[model samples]
Target: MKMAARTKARHESLGLSLEDVVQMYRVMLQTRMIGERMMQLNRMGKAMFVGVADGHEAAEVGSAWCIRKGVDWCVPYYRDVGVALVLGQTAKDQFLGVFAKATDPNSGGRQIVNQFSDVKAKMLSGSVHIATQFPHAVGLALAAKIRKQDHIVVTYGGEGATSPGDFHEAMNFAAVHELPVVFVIENNQYAISTPVKLQMAVANVADRAAAYGMPGVIADGTDVLDVYEKTKQACDRARGGDGPTLVEVKCYRYRPHSSDDDDSRYRSKDELQAWLQKDPIDKAAAYLLQQAVAASRLEDMRQEIAADIEAAITAAENDPDPDPATLTRYVYGEDAE
Candidate 1:
C-alpha cells in the first residue's frame, strides 16, 4: 500500500510522525466506540445516563493529545469522556462511573456519569454545570506560574459554556496574568436544544479571545489532524508564557444531548444527516486509509476495541456498588459529625 501524498505531506508539515497520528486516530476510535456502547447500555437500562462524544471525538482526542498526561493538567467537562480516555482513564474506569460501581475513582458512584477524574493523569474532576471548570483550570495555571513550573493547563467545554460568566472570568484572568492555559470550545452548534444562533450574538466563539487579549483560532473538529495541529500550536503558545488561547473547534453532536434529551424536537433530520456525513471517526479512518493503512487492519483494530469495551462492561457490572454505609464518607468532615 502506498501512502497518499497529501496525507503524508500534511503530517510532515505538522512535525508529526505517521505513528503519532495513527495512535491519535486509535484513541478517537476508542472514544467513539465507548460512547456508542454507553448509549446502548442506557437504552438497555444497564446505565443511567450518557453524555456521548460521537461527533466531537476529534476535538477531544486531538486536543488531549497535545497535553502531557502526567505533566499538564486537563480540566474536562462532563461531555469530555474522550479527553479522559486519552488521558489514560480506560473504558473500564468510565464504565465504573457509568454503572455507579464502588470501584469508580471519580466519585465512588456519587457523581453523575462522565465526570472523569484521575490524579495520576493530572485530569481534574469535572462537574455537570457548564463553564465551571474554566476557573479551575485558570487557577491551576496560575499556581504553575507562581511556582515557576513548566506545567500548563488544558480545559474543554461546549460553545454554550462560553456564554457563562465563568468563561469570561477565566479568560480575563488568564490573559491578564499570562497564565499557561488553553481553552478549547467544542462548538457543536447547539447547547442542548438551543442553537448557536440563539446562544450568543458572536459569529465565532474564538473571536471573543481577542477581547481578552489572546489569540483566537478556529479549527475543523471533524479532522483529527487539523485539530491536533491547532491544539499543538495552542499548547506551545501557552507553555511559552504567551498567555491563553481560545480555540473553537467546529463540530456537531450526532446524538441527543444525553440519553434523556429529545433532539428531534430541535434539530432537523437533514441537518443531522449532514453532520453524520462528517463524523470524526470516519474522517480519521479515511486519512489512515490514505496513508496506506489496510482496510482489514482497520477492521481488526475495531474488533480489538470492541472486545476491550465488552471486557470493561463485564468488569464494571461485576464490580459491587458503593457501600451504602459509607454514603457520607467524602461528603462531610469527621469533625462535622
Candidate 2:
C-alpha cells in the first residue's frame, strides 16, 4: 500500500513552456549522469571516494541558474559537483579532480576535488568539515559589502549540517549585517544513518529564518521550477538590499551519503522505494517528452552528454598523476617553508 501511494505521487514538472522544462530537464539528467559516472569510477578503484548529488540536482541547478557566475561568489560543499559544474566547471576539471590527475582544473591534481579553487569563477574552495561553508559564505558576502560590489554569495549544505552551531551563527551574521547571501539547505531526509526528524524539531529548515528577521521559503527540490522560482526571488531581494533568505529544499537521497554508507542499516526499504519513484531527472525527462520535445532532439542531447562524459573519463584516466616531488610546494604560500 505504501509503495503504491508513494509511486502515485510522482512529481509533476512545473513550468509554463516546453523550452524552460527541457533546459532544466537536461541539467538534472547531466547531474545524475555525473554522479553515476563517479560511482562507476569508485567501484573500479580508480577513485578513492564519490559524493553523489543524485537527489539534490534540482536544488543545486536551481540555485546556480539564478546567479551570475563571474559576478557572484559560491561557497560550495563536497556534494556540490553538479551545482558547480552547471555554474561553470568543465567535465575534464571535475573528472580530473576525482582522479587526482595533474590535468585537474582547479588544483592541477594537488588538492582534493572538494577544495575547488577558481578565482575567475569566484568559487570559494570547499572544505571537508560540514557546515564550515556557511561562515565562509558569510565572510565573502561581508567582503563584497565592504568593497561596495554588487556580487552576492550563495552557500549550500545539508539539513544534517544545520544541527551544528556554525550554521546558526552564519545565518545570524548574514542577517544582522543584511549580507547579500543565500543560505540553502538541501534537506535530503537522511544524513548518513540519522534521519531529518532526529536532527531537528521543526518539519522545515526555513522556519528558523524568522529569528533572523529574513524571508524564508520551502521549495520542492524534486521539481526544478519550484527551486528556480524561489532562488530567483531570494537573489532579487538580496540584490535589492533586503537582506538574506533561508531556503529549505525538501528532497530525497536515493543513495547513501557516500559510497561507503549502507543506508539499509538505518532506513527501511519501503522509504527508499518511496523516494525512488519520484526521481527528479526521470520525472523532468518525462515532462520534456510530454511537452513534445522532438524525440530526435532528446536523443541528440543524450548522445552529446554521453560523449562528453566518456571523453572526460578517458582523458582523466590517462592523464599524468600528480607528482610527489612537489607535495609541499604550496604548503605555506609561495615564500613560506
Candidate 3:
C-alpha cells in the first residue's frame, strides 16, 4: 500500500535532505535484499540456520542512522542486520558470518549467524541469550559517563526481551544512574510462537518505560522518517545527559522467527498477508516516488543492491572454513595465537 503523500516540508522538518531520504530508502532496500538472500541460502542448506529481518528494515535503519558510528556504541540483538549494515558492516562481512567462514569478522565462524559485531563501528557482539545486551549497553553508557565522553549507547531487542529480569534490572540501573543510553524495542508482535498478548498485559512495550522513570515514545516502524525522528530525539536526550529513553517501534516480521520455525503453527496466513500489505520497503519506495524520485531510479537501486549481494554470497561461499586446530584458540588464553 502507498504511504501518505510525501512532502518536502515533512522531511525538511526532520532536518533530512531529499538525498538523505533517498539514501535511507536505499539502506532499507539493501537490508531487505540481504535478508532474502540469506533465507535462500538457508533453504539451499548452505547455511545451517538463519534469521531474516524481513520487515524490520525501517526500524533498524532509521534508528541506527541517528548514531555516530565509531563514537556512539550499538548493542544490537540478532535480528538487527540493518543496524549492522548502517553501522559500516559490509554485505560481504555478513555473508561471511552466515557462511561460517574463517574470515568472518564477527567471530571468525565461532558465533552464530546474524550475531553481528564490528569493532571499528563500536558495535558489540550480540549474545544468544535474550536481554543480555541491555545490561551491556548500560555498562557502556556508564563508562561513557565516567569518562565524561559525549557518546551515548543504543541497544535493541524484541518485545519478548522486555519480559526478562535482565531488561528490568538494566532499565532501573540506567534510570537511577542517569546513564546515556537508549533502549529500543522492536515490537514485532510476536516472540517466537507467542504473541504480544501473551507476553504482557500492557497495551504497548513503551508503556512499561514510565515505571522506570523515563519517557516512552512510540513510532510507526514502517515509516522510516518517523523512526528516525523519534530515535534522534531520544539519542539527543541521552547525549545531553537526560538519561535513557525507551523508544518502541511497532513492527511486524514477515518471516518466521528463524529458519527452524514454522510460523503457520502460530499465526494465520491472513495475518501475514495483512502485514505484507504494509511492507516497510514498499512504504519507503512510495515516499521516494512522491518526492519525485524516478521509478526507474528505484528499480536501478534494487538491481545494484541485488548484484552486490550476489557477489558477496559468491565470495563468502568461496572463502575458507575455520581450521579444526584453531577451535580452542579464542576459547583459551594461551592458545589465542
Candidate 4:
C-alpha cells in the first residue's frame, strides 16, 4: 500500500446506520466506565495492575464483534479493555481479577491469567507483553488449520508493538504458512510518551503490511462503525484463506498509558485536552440520541450500567482473596505427582 493510502482511504465515513451505533453504545460506555473505575480500584487499594483503555474502545469492540465469535480467536493486548468486555468478561470478572478474588472468570481465583475465555466465544487471553500474543495467536491459527477448522485469529496491538520483531515475524510466518490471522493496530498516535511519528518512518502502520505481501488499510478507529466495517472486511479476508491483513486504527489516548505512568510527565495539557474533545463514548452517545433513541431510555441505560458496575465492585470486594499458598499451583507446569 502507498504511504498516503491509509490517510486517503480514511477520512471517508462508511455510512454506518444509527441502529448499529445504538446497539454498541451501551457496551462502549460500560467499557469506558470500567476503565475509569479500575483506576479508582487502584487508588482505593484493590487492584495491583490496571491497563485502562479510555481511547481504544471502538477498535477493540468493533474488531471483536465483527469476527465470528467463538469461531475465531482474539489475542488482545493489555489495553484492550473494551474488547475483553465485548468478548464476555463481565464487570465482576475483570474487577475480580483486579481484586485477586476467587470466582474470577479465567481461573475461579486459581489463576491470574487471561480474564475470560469460551472456545464458543473465540475470545483468547489478552496478554500484557506488547507483541508476545502475536506468535501465540499464530500457533492457534496453525492448530485451527491443521485440524481443518474454519476459525480465524485476530491479533491486536498498539502502534508501539509494530516496532517489535515479534510483529514482523508473526506477519511474515503467517503469510508464509497462509494462516488465518488478522493483525489490528490501534494506532493512538502515541505510545505513552513516545509519539508514533517518532516510533516509525512509515506514515501509517497499515502501509507497512505490503512488506509481508498482505493488504494493509487504515480505519477511523474513533468511529466504531468504521472500525466495524474495516475489521469485518479483514475477518472475511482471513476466513477465505486470503491470509493476514494489517488494519491501522487511528485514535488517541485520553489518559496516561497506565496507572504507574502519567502522561502529564511527557505530554502537554493541550494535547490531552485535544484528544478528550473527541471522546468516543460521547460521540456514540450523541449519534444515538440523534438516531431518535429515547432520552429517558438512554438515561435508564446509564443508570443500569452504573448499578451493574457497582455490584461488580462489591462482589469483587466481598469475595475472599486467593489462598496465599496456591499462587504456585497454576504457576508451573503440572508436576508428575
Steric clash count of candidate 4: 3
**RMSD list, candidates in order:** 2.8, 6.1, 3.5, 6.3
| lDDT digits (tens) for residues 1-337 of candidate 1 | 9876743368789888878877888888888899899999999999988889889989998888899869999999888888888888898998999999999989899999988787888988777888999999999999999999989999999999999999999999999999999999999999999999999888999889989899999999999888989999999999988889999999998989999999999989999898889888898888889888888988998899999999999999999999999898977656744
Q: What shift in Å separates residue 250 of candidate 1 from its native position after superposition?
A: 0.6
lDDT of 3 by residue, 1-337 (tens): 9898865567899998989989888888898899888998899988999998989999999999999988999999999999999999889999999999999999999999988877898999878999999999999999999999988999999999999999999999999999999999999999999999999999999999899999999989988999999999999999899999999999999999999999999999999889889888899888889878899999999899999999999999999999989898766556323
lDDT of 2 by residue, 219-308 (tens): 888877778888878988889888899988889877778888888889898987788787777767676776666878878888888899
* Index of the highest-lDDT prediction: 3
* Weakest ten-residue segment in model 3 by summed lDDT: 328-337
State candidate 3's TM-score.
0.96
What lDDT does each candidate get?
A: 0.90, 0.81, 0.93, 0.78
Q: 2 or 3, which is superior by lDDT? A: 3
True-structure RMSD for candidate 4:
6.3
Model 4 Cα lDDT, one tens digit per residue, 184-302: 99998888779987999989999898998888999987778778889888888889888888888998877788777878777788986887787777777776776567889778988
TM-score-superior candidate, 1 or 4: 1
- Which one wins on TM-score? 3
